[model samples]
Target: MQNRQNQIEPEWTIIKILQWTTSYFKTNGIDSPRSTAEILLAHTLGFKRIDLYLRHDQPLNVGERNLFKSLIRRRISKEPVAYIVGSKEFWSLELVVSKDVLIPRPETECLVEEALLVLDKDKVSAPKRILELGTGSGAIILAMATQNPDQQYFASDISINALAVALNNARHLGLDEKIDLFCGSWVSPLKENNNLFDIIISNPPYIRRGDIKTLQPEINRFEPINALDGGEDGLACIKHIIKNAHKFLNKSGTLLLEIGYDQKKAVDEIIKETGRYAQASFRKDYSGFDRVVCAKKAYD
Candidate 1:
């Protein structure tokens, strides 16, 4: 243990450091200690996680050890692994993330999956138009565009910094030219565009205000509060989107949303209250929790 020191013992190899870090993380009550250790170590060494095993016997020089030590300290402080490593994988595509945006979770991929399914089933021959609200890191829109490149895609976010991250991701994924990016709340900026989209989707903030503080420290402490707080009952953003989406969707257009697991019933009611959709349905994530809401506008 090199506390307040710049150098690790010269004999510390990749395997040795991983073992030590995993134990240290576990003792500190970090979740997925071994996986965290491997990710951080791989990030510090600029190698893929698989490469760590291939180079298990390689010794770390002083600089590499120092960097890994700093990352370990940050982890011990409960900073998220995604922020520390600066990326997360969603829909099998690696996306850039920061504290300015919510880290794309696996559950949200369910929204993308359902939206793609809807698009696939659509009998329309012409290219369809799509819009995504709160497009943090542009994960959903980018994934959708990648799968169906012919569609016109647009995304909006309230935070300019978040939009910047999304733009960076879009550029890296080579979908920048394909997706139009906007910086504004939900449908505000889209109102003047005069574009009625075939599909409207979002993964808005759905955590109740009171519950924000109760989340994991990695989320409550490190991720943006604005991206997590969903007002009094965790339905503020969801309600707003549900109410406004039909205005921008074409006749029979589909609206897809990634919502909190327990929000299905409430969101369903919100959809009904609007009297804007002809049909609405819910989909479960891999964990069998209600995660996405699919609502279709009335043709008449």
Candidate 2:
């Protein structure tokens, strides 16, 4: 067999393969090369990431090497690692994902954190009704349900295919029964429903439509366009949610939204313009960027 250096090799061992793949990924400008190499190799060998180091001396058979090679090729083309592996760990839960939905992001955990804070404060009363819009992969709702199981959970998505992925993830996480899934844009499906939520949350598409192509290739090329396009100013979804959420929120209900890093001012303005929410505020992500916005419905 040909080795990484293109010379003949009797066998390709785990350590050698990892070293080769890491160098190759680096040369190709792939991020986190060593970690990517380990993830792909571990997946191919049916081992955990740490297991790869433990079995460093183990030899990869032809079949295993071929599978690893295929994954590497896909990665080199900029397909997301989550899509390649078919799952992503968000809030410590492995969620199913696809091109139909935006991959669950770590920054979105800020939204979950804010949501949990709201839920915690309301726990002394009866179970609070909670709703999440654009619930891709059910990440936010599921994470909240996992932590605060006493609340009533509901989630909606515009894309049926995206909802399917979220539903499957919910089932996998055993949260299917906990969250009621709906298919429609924003709060459309809930317009006729009598239930008013104590908390409404979302991590909507906020990328400017024209700026979608400017994002990283893994996002611009591979992820769903509908899940990324945020119209001319990247606030279409945000505006819609802010304007319509009042109809579904109980008096003084909280709205928590994950926003673009630079959107604090604009979103703050939108919330103020509607005169529906007061004390519009923001929470920063680990990177110190304003990643989540919080506001409460203005009581009449």
Candidate 3:
């Protein structure tokens, strides 16, 4: 390996480097080994991910190779790739993220999916009022607003740092003006807000307190605890939103939330307990897990 490094025309090319990194990552127990290698290499080279294939035979200089080695070291230590790169792609829109916010996951996209379904079905007028609770990184609301530009949207978070990342992303996508952002927990900022929304959506923290310790290192270590802890049974945040959502929804307005797969029965009971929602149902993600719960307000 040392001799190959010093060759004037090094034998280590893009394809060769990727092969080595892929095997190395696999040995270290990283999932999607090949893809992880490609993503990190592309970031290190400042090239588009697909560009990697186009330049398969390209050789890196000593400095570039060293940078990739550094990135690999970070990954080996279990640092999340998104945080390493400082952004992640969600709903096909790349959003900035950091330790302050949960990295957007594919399952959360289902929240956006169900929201669009409700919007299209209602065919409500443009500027349909929508609010998202616990809007970490603004993933759900921004994706919804981007696709439905006519909607009036608002999102709130208690952590200023997370909100800052979300704000930057909104500005980057030129959708900043579309969302009214607030710095407060749950419904605090919406006080005195009578029947204000046509739809309320959130992917709030629902991971059980005990279960969090069993999560992947990527989650348990890198992600923020406040954003993951659901208190005792992981329903603390969910229950609060369900109870207050009725007060903020117009007649027949909707409250959509994402919850743990197994929490369906528990959350269902919470919705029923309020008796404020007319219809409560769940939507499965691409993986066929009960990932999102939808509740329609009962007329006052």
Candidate 4:
């Protein structure tokens, strides 16, 4: 019998490659191996899932076969599919992603949902001012402005590279006119101006430094550490925003934040210490973990 491991050209077909890749992924501890294989193959072919079905029996051209082999090698090395594809979907919007930005997580969608609820209750009208700190890929702000066309949005990020990615997404989504993009740390660009926002939202760095090493290889190896490391306790950025957000928030304005699952107590304490916010509370993610914290500026 031919040795499968030693053979250079294993005479694999497209359908066979899919089966092999799926099994390889499963053996490597990847969850949803079959779905991952389908998505990755579709992405490699520049086709949709249904299209894959249509061409399941089609033979891959030599160039296509080489490309699939390269991608499979990378996948075996534990690279994230989003990074390989150079884009990710968040809040139903396709956003460009790179090593400069953290891939937007589904959990962060909770921040968007909570922000919309606050806007609804506050009755915010047209030309509403909204600020998003650390707007990586502009996912959150773009999603918000797309949903609420009447709102005027502002976004800032500490990394210039991340800002570039975000600006591209905003332009691609036809939201450039609705958002003012800034390049700087959290709340820094807003400090020089007296502009207060009706709503402020952020999904800042909230992962502890030590814990980052323990994360999955796809995250630790590929994602920008600066965007994930939240200092020793994972509350560095959270505390900074909580301390500074009140200054940029309109009276009675709301602040929405995405927090680490174990960070509810620390974040709640920060809000309480600020003495500038009331009705501080947290909402759980779809996983039923406390993931979002919402607070409002104290009514004077």
Candidate 5:
């Protein structure tokens, strides 16, 4: 029991804490043990991961040690590091996150990549206008604006809390001036405006209600249900977006959406039935899953 007591002690150094946290996470079935340990420790120390290595042997003081222990305990309970650190890196930007918004997933980057491709193909002029629906952390829209500085962007979410988080991220990334934001259900906030976008992108909620229970505890338990629960079959929001998107999209605008692996056929069918889109196609993510669907509105 003495060994157990030592493991829980707060006096551990930077290196020792790293070793302990990694082993603890691994024993608890966390797949990315070492990386998780490094991120959590770096966050607690207010230093970058590389700085942590440079100060490997340095001891953490009482305050720092206590904070590290608190974060370690939360991790052991299966809390996501993004929640613990209150930020996540997406598209090379560290964006703030919380229970109010879904943690940005790496796969969602494909949405941005797909958007850039569509924009390039169309050869949109400078200051092209873009709209993003369900902009949880504002990661997708903000990343695009950051890359295409001349692009004007707008982001909207159904959750007011989510819009707040997205707004904060916009401010932190210095993209606030370039991006307009709104709150309310999809299309509601923009209905009165006649502004047509060159591209519309989204990472809407896609998990089926029944499947939520099967997700990892860090997600199903801690993440907001409204951000993950996609009505009965997970296609509710996607269907709504597809039906109304044409009204907001310019004649030649593109719609880029992130979908679940099994959702490709259903979403594809929806796009086909709409009859307002052309060249609708799916792009696989890094994991080889059919993840992003791109469709362009007919020029007519």
Candidate 6:
């Protein structure tokens, strides 16, 4: 039996490898083992995930086995598959990503949806200036700008590397001309210019500093800490953005933000306490967690 098993191991096929790797992933505490198995295997083989099933009986070449093995080990080590593949899909668009930026998550799309909802009220097609701070990889602004190309867009990040990745993605999507990129913290980019925007959107870091170490290993260890930590209360960035957003908004301009589920009440209170906003509201994500905050500046 031992000799037969040893002799047959060299003939592993796509389906065989997938079954073996799926079990391996489960044993290592990885979630969605089968789905992850397919994604990593397909990525290593340069095949679409569905295509992997099509050629299930095809034997892996020596190179393919070596590469797939490396990816499997990385997954076992808790690296996010999106980083391993080097791109992620947001708003139905594929954007390049690296360790320099946070992988755009599906929940952030709610922020985009809310922004578009507000923009729909605009009767004319005139360009409306919009700005996204902490624009990691330019996901939010790029996705919004792509959908509303006529709008003047600007994106900024404090991290040079993050800004570089965002710029690369902007150029990749042919959005460079439409989005004015900058490197600054929060609203400082146009502070001197006295710039005002019709819409301001952000998904700034909202994770509590101490709680970061308690998050999943893939997130706490792999993603950028600066993009995750929001200080002792987890409202540091949110508070700053809220406090300053009104100063940069046009009359009755809108400000939309993606926030942590637990932060809805706290953020809503902050918005109300400010006394600059007309009224603030919250939107829930698919899981029924309060995921976004929508507010408008008072028309003076």
Error of 5 at 206 (Å): 0.9
Q: Estimate each model's TM-score.
A: 0.95, 0.95, 0.95, 0.93, 0.93, 0.95
lDDT of 2 by residue, 1-300 (tens): 436644434358999999999999999999999999999998898899999889888888778888999999999999999999998999999888998988988898888998888877775668899999988888899999999898899999988988999999988988889999998888887753486998999988899999988899999999999888889999999999999898889989999999998999999999999998887989999999999999999997
Position 156, candidate 6: lDDT: 88
lDDT of 5 by residue, 1-300 (tens): 979766655457789989988999899898699999999889888899999889888877768878888988898889999999999999999999999999999999898998988877766467678999999889999989888888788989888888899989988988889888988898877763396888888888899999999999999989999888788999998999999888888777888889999999999999999998996899999999999999989876
Clashing pairs in 6: none
Q: List runs of model 2 lying over 4 Å from the truth.
A: 1-10
lDDT of each: 0.91, 0.90, 0.91, 0.87, 0.88, 0.92
TM-score of model number 4:
0.93
What's model 5's overall lDDT? 0.88
Off by over 4 Å in 3: 1-9
In candidate 5, position 31 carries an lDDT of 69
lDDT of 6 by residue, 1-300 (tens): 989966786678999999999999999899999999999999888999989889988888778999999999899999999999899999988999999999999999999999998898886677899999999999999988889898999888999999999999999999899999889999876773389999999999999999999999999999999999999999999999999889999888999999999998899899999888988989999889999999999876
Local lDDT at 7 for model 2: 42
lDDT of 3 by residue, 186-283 (tens): 98778645538999999888888999999999889899999999999999999999999888887788999999988999999999999899768999
The whole-model C-alpha lDDT of candidate 4 against the native structure comes to 0.87
Better of 1 and 5 by lDDT: 1
Off by over 4 Å in 4: 1-13, 124-126
Write candidate 1's Cα lDDT for 70-171 as tens digits: 999999999999999999998889999999999988888889999999999987789999999999899999999999999999999999999999999999
State in Å the error of residue 275, model 5.
1.5
- Output the lDDT of residue 75, model 5: 86
Q: Write the per-residue lDDT of candidate 4 for residues 1-300, one digit (tens) a residue.
A: 347533534455557778988999899888688888888888878988788778777666667778877887787888888988888999999889998999999999999999988877765355678999999888899989988988889999989999899989988988888888888889877753387998899999999999999999999999999999999999999999999888988878889999999999989999999899996989999999999999999986
Consecutive 10-residue window with the lowest summed lDDT within model 5: 4-13
